[model samples]
Target: MAVRAEQRVDYLALDGEKSWVDFEVKVLWLVGVRGRFGSVHGMIKVDHFRSAATVEAQIDANVVSMRSKSHEEWVKSPEFFDAEHYPQILFVSDPIPLKRLQNGGEIEGTLTLRGISKPVRLNLIKPDCPGESADNCPVEAEGSIRRSDFGMSSRRGTLSDKVELSFSIATKPMNGSSAIP
Candidate 1:
């Protein structure tokens, strides 16, 4: 169903689904030779609906505007990431079917990395707290998977077998005229 333009939607709601407050699709996680970098951007869930969803994601690995602690050398390695080859990473999820949570729910979807795509899940939450940012919401979901599944097998031993994924979302109605951007 498409929401009418007259609908007083929340700007934070991403002008899409029902996600409230609009949790900034902040950062991401990647294990390097020395440690981990959780500051990459362009591939965040941001927010979602109970039965449907739209994720905020990107595919640039040159330098993450979100994470600031990553060593310049880490971003320039073949084992960590071959920015010369795989310049883009992507993730697109189906209509998030909610599974209920203490504050929200959990939904499963597919995640694409280094050009390989695989199934993954995350938490969703609602925004009812006093914080301007996404601290708590009605929906929250998370899951784990092997990086190698997506062809991101860089530091085999230095990195863990499982990658932790997390998310929180809130809705404020939409026009339904959305296609994965």
Candidate 2:
């Protein structure tokens, strides 16, 4: 009898080019406010053979912006994000199955906010591939987290505990090539 060997494939590294991370939270227990971070950077690795993927990202907490300047300032204050103290929000995910992601699955990961690291599960929508290749692919995902879990407990009655997050990430091959096939 002959023994067969299993094949292993290397993951393709993709760099995030243009990405946006936004959050929506209810204020005053009724009104919804949306804000977005101005600076973001990340990298993603995809294993085509295994249909697995991993993502790591950093968001600049100080660059948060909203329609209202006062609201933006308030969010940056110690009462909320405390951007001066916590300069960055980080996220790293475990290996996620691409098949499940294609069918609207969730990615389990750890999100560090306000200097507190906690587990978070982000629900992913089917990735929208603009072209046939993997290069220049943009992905969108949404999830929510409790502010109290991250030590953001100020104004409990006025601000909702749950904060909804959404992301739009555009990726390109790390090798400085066109879309990855």
Candidate 3:
């Protein structure tokens, strides 16, 4: 009898060219401040036999774009992201059920920002075409995190500690095969 091999699927974010990681935080307890990281790269690996998937992503903190140059400068300063010290923000998810990713659910992951790692849950959105194709179709998720948890606890009364995060990306096959193989 022949043994059957386990199948796996992998997707790449295309060097993060078509990916966007945006954030919005409340300022002065009333105004909303927004910004986005310009460089992001990540990969998704799905194990068919195990019905599990994992995601790993990285963001360049040095390439942040905000509403104003002054705001951008403030974010990159030691009081915030501190790009000089920690230039990269990383997130790696625990193995999640493939069905959860397809059907839209929470994905548990650890986000490492400013050299501090914390558990975060992102709400995944179901794609338009499920189990059909991952190319062109964007995979999106959103969640919120407290800045103080990552050691950015400088401004408690001025800037809201909660940061709303939005992530979206279009992926291509990592090995020249379809999403499911």
RMSD of each: 8.3, 4.7, 3.0
Clashes of each: 28, 2, 0
Q: Which candidate is the best by TM-score?
A: 3
Question: lDDT per model, in order?
Answer: 0.45, 0.78, 0.85
TM-score per model over all chains: 0.51, 0.83, 0.88
Model 2 TM-score relative to the real fold: 0.83
Which segments of model 2 are wrong by more than 4 Å?
1-17, 129-132, 176-181
What lDDT does model 2 reach?
A: 0.78
Per-residue lDDT for 81-125 in model 2, tens only?
Answer: 899999889999898887865676788899998899999999888
**What lDDT would candidate 1 get against the real structure?**
0.45
Clashing pairs in 3: none
- Give the clash total for candidate 1: 28
TM-score of 3: 0.88
- Model 3, residue 160: what's the lDDT? 95
lDDT of 1 by residue, 32-110 (tens): 2232222333222323332333455443455432234554455545654466777655545565433333345555566
lDDT (tens digit, per residue) of candidate 3 on 77-104: 9999999999999999999897876788
